[model samples]
Target: MSIQVGDTLPDVEIRVVSNGIEEGRTGPLFAGRKVVLFAVPGAFTPTCSNRHLPGYVQHLAQFQARGVEVMCLAVNDAYVMQAWAASQNVPPELLMLADGNGNFTKAMGLELDGNAYGMGLRARRFALYAENGVVKALQVEAPGEFRVSTAEAILEALA
Candidate 1:
């Protein structure tokens, strides 16, 4: 089933990079904290690079001030995610997570069919507000739309 509000995030392993590449479980990462996790179809795509990710990056402080940890999740590999982070000059406070094999994306039932685009398996654009591992609010954008998943929308939902 698709994850929804009031559901505990699946305890699936997702990859992240700090001093070096590391793996973290979704449950532990979302535990005991308020988190805003947003996913893009892929890194470096026009909408993702120009808007989705940047929206969160630009308003990062606002999210932090409200005591929320902001994260960007994508189906790309750690190397691609790391390069995108560096190219965008993403702040240390914001985390970029890679669901290398689409394990987490598939687990959440948010995988997009990218076969037509030659991208293979990818994540559908979405965002969620989770507190202590339970989802409080969730937004899944319609294809080719950028409304509900933006930082502004998520912030408003939090309010």
Candidate 2:
């Protein structure tokens, strides 16, 4: 089943580009903190680069002002994530996570099959809010749609 409100985030290894691709678990990242994690189907894709990620980048301070750490996750590797971040001019505080191998995506039951697109396994476009390791809200988009998972939408939901 897909993760829902009140579910504790699954423990899984994720990679982040810190001093050259440091690895860590999902547990401590959400433990004792409020987090807004949004995933894209792929990095550098048209919609993701133009709308999804840039929305978060534009409104990052609003989320931070609400005491939430914003994260952008994709199934790509840390190197790609780092390059994307640099290309987008992402702020240092906004984390870029690499869910390589789709472990975390599968654990959350949010994996998207993109074999037809020649993309292989990828993450569905979605966003979630969590506090102290427990999910509070989740917004998943319909296939080929981008509605409820936007930064503005998530902030409005939090409000």
How large an RMSD does model 2 have?
0.9
TM-score per prediction, in order, is 0.97, 0.97
- TM-score of model 2 relative to the true fold? 0.97
| Alpha-carbon local distance difference test for all models | 0.91, 0.94
lDDT of candidate 2 over 18-116, digit per residue (tens): 345789999887799999999999999999999999999999999999999999999999999999998998988889989989999999999999999
lDDT for each residue of candidate 1 in 1-159, tens digit (9 for 90 to 100):
688888888889988854456788888888899999999999999999999999999999999999999989999999999889988878878999999999999988889999999999999999999999898899999998999999999989888
lDDT (C-alpha) at residue 56 in model 1: 96
RMSD of each: 1.0, 0.9
Off by over 4 Å in 2: 18-20
For candidate 2, the 10 contiguous residues with the lowest summed lDDT are 15-24
